[model samples]
Target chain A: MGEAIVVTSGKGGVGKTTTSANIGTALALLGKKVCLVDTDIGLRNLDVVMGLENRIIYDICDVAEGRCRLNQALVKDKRFDELYMLPAAQTKDKNAISPEQVRDIVLELKKEYEYVIIDCPAGIEQGFKNAIAGADRAIVVTTPEHASVRDADRIIGLLEGSHVESPKLVVNRIRPNMVKSGDMLDIEDVIQVLNIDLIGIVPDDEHVIKAANNGEPTVMNPDSGAAIAYRNIARRILGDTVPLMPLNQKKGAFTRFKKFLGIGG
Target chain B: MTVKSNHVTIKGIKDGLVFLLDDQCEFSELLNELRYKLEHSHQNILTGPIMHVDVKLGMRNISEEQKTLILDTLKQKGNLLIRSVETQGCVPEDEAGSSLHTLCGLVRSGQVLRHEGNLLFLGDVNPGGQIICSGDVIVVGALRGMAHAGADGNEFAIIAASYMAPTQLRIAEIISRPPDEWENRESSMEFAFLRGGTMQIDKINNVGKVRPDFNVFKGV
Candidate 1:
């Protein structure tokens, strides 16, 4: 059977949905059959992030409650033939579906898909439990802020207690300039606090928001730094040893020329 | 003339009366002698105002039932009050209930590691993580979280860490200042202890000086 990975962060507003959408799309682009499951229930946003909100006929609740078949509830991605999303129910609360039901649904999807990515909801509540119930592995998403890192540590402890094998960490929204200026926490600081294996680091890019506004994930754009980071994470998940992308961008030619003339660096 | 064995002796002290019970005699014989002394021989002393009686059992270990029997026998006398019953050569109650517990893992945020006695942690205690111990807390790694040593109010307990930056430190009931007050970046190992009801931080090397008994190891 294929492996199921859950994307979770204990705190809210830490880019769990965005990372899930991008990772799922990247895996599909890498010639793998990927199924993205949105376990947020009433607060579903993965469908909108994947640009599949308009095509959701039946949701995860319907499938769990036996109102429809699993395939019927899945919304196929418009861009990639190998990518499909099982949207969450917008009307039902997180308690509408149990962990066992989510596990069964994920097991059924694992038989057909090569990779099943579950987009977990924020907070260590019923939604988070349901998301990680059937996951073989887990990806803990966090920013470099103190609150996010603290919450990520809490989530890592819970995931380990649940026996999810050494969940990898993905530090999102890193600003290299702020880090250099000593205003924000650097990648090394976050890693030292969380004390987990780093899977990827996505630099803060304006294109992530711009692409999300257009109902497309940032991974669809090849030039964005966030896109490259997500692709590297997908490749790492596939057992590829890709080097970490450099966060510091090289100076422009004019700046270099100015620095050569002893004006500015 | 017959030689009488003195199984119990009563002494007059400044505060009250001291009862020196012979440890080498049989418990029943000692009880009988104590009863006879208090009822007949020492009846004149017991006729006055309430006198505090201190029972000193030297080199004798007795169970709770036997101690209660002594207390009851003392209570039978009208003007006698039992002050303290002390035994020699036995560990104190607080020390007897404590032990050393070793833990090797990350104590992450929202996770609490509570132990009844001393705790020896070999991993980092991240922000929001906590360690509540009754005896002492010793960390071989970074201590960035809250650690409450002497959770049961043993003020002599201490907290030691290699990297001694912590959000908060508590010894007994006294809480440390906020993180801003003692934001130490010192590379040396440090420990926290309570002195005169106030928490103090010092280098770990001086622990033996602060608490002489802290050096449990003998010579090399």
Candidate 2:
């Protein structure tokens, strides 16, 4: 009954890991049993980002290769009781596990958890293929840049090719001032290039970098710009109708009047 | 021909044995040497090892007569597979560095297609996908990726697309980004080419009159 969603972006360094960690954390805070699976294999960072790297005695390869039980490799997070992480192996190659193996593991995880969020690796190779094998939905994270937008378009096309219904988009690290000055791609431009349903837009905040470096996800920082956006996105995922927060106070007069009306702000 | 040289040399490869023929040797000499080696060294080359022997005729402008002669000789000896016959220096005059290539599917992200002649794409060139050709490029569908026509410094190459909202475009040495007010852009069959010193995009409203630089299916 649980939904397994794969967080993927064709291009690297576009916040797939950040989105995965934050969204997983937000869902767990909402009282849902969540498990984040890192399928990046040789370059695993989801455990480090979730601050659960030290608790890993066994990893995904160990469970897939029959060396340990699935529950034994599931690392419980210190912050949330309902949250768990299935860390990837650092020493093994990407070809160590197959798509069928990942599908079987995710299927087993789905039986116990309400949300199984998979962190897919970059590129459309074997690792990306294995990560999305058993997912019921997809979330494509991208930056408001030309390369990232194009990559998001391709990933959306690929997800649709695999019959994943309408992958959602999360435009990450968007600088409002630059977008205002026409120096960078705006949210509208990113959406136009990708042509997917917009779910969230995380601003380019330096606190995100600090939180990630401290082995903490940005969603835990309530004062951070990305945190509010991620929380709103989580609320939306829970089927709540929440309006997006404005980037700055440069709204039109009509929009400002609507914001004061208590209907949406 | 009474050949007096060992023109065929067989080496052990991971998949099979590769028989390399010297390019300077005559076709009749190489064929005679290959037949002699296959008939005499059957026990030493193909007896116990579960392997196939492949002939590598390198850089020689082999004719149809020479290819059939080699295939017939190999078949009369044993059940052998011809791995490849690579002619390094024998590309045809028209096909050398100037032949049209048609890519028939969606060009995915991180995929690059580079050709020396014109390119005819039959699908969507998604973002992050690049197509660099030395001649003109014609896309039958959306062109949202980066495309560089006339990559070999031919400034007269034109790029035509059904949906021409490309990430970046380069014709010869000039590059241009799409205008910012392109949000309301429609599918009007646009084409890009160099005018004066800058790249200019124009709609293909009149298809009857051909431009001075435009030519179809003509290359070296």
* Best DockQ among the predictions, by candidate number: 1
Model 2 stretches astray by more than 4 angstroms:
A249-265, B1-125, B128-142, B146-189, B192-202, B211-220
Candidate 1 ranges with C-alpha deviation above 4 Å = A254-265, B1-99, B179-181, B216-220
Model 2 DockQ, alpha carbons vs. true complex: 0.22
Tens digit per residue, CA lDDT, model 2, A60-106? 99999999999999999989999999999999978999999999999
Interface RMSD of each: 0.4, 2.8
For candidate 2, what is the DockQ-based docking class?
incorrect
Best TM-score among the predictions, by candidate number? 1
Per-model TM-score on C-alpha atoms: 0.79, 0.62
- lDDT (10s digit) by residue, model 2, range B143-181: 888899889887767788988988899989999898876
Candidate 1 lDDT over residue span A141-231, tens digit each:
9999999999999999999899588999999999988998999998998999998999999999999999888899999899999999999
Q: Looking at model 1 chain B, report the run of 10 residues with the lowest lDDT sum.
A: B211-220
Candidate lDDT (C-alpha), each: 0.90, 0.83
Tens digits of per-residue lDDT for model 1 on B2-73? 227886788899989989887667898888888888777655788889999999886456889999999999
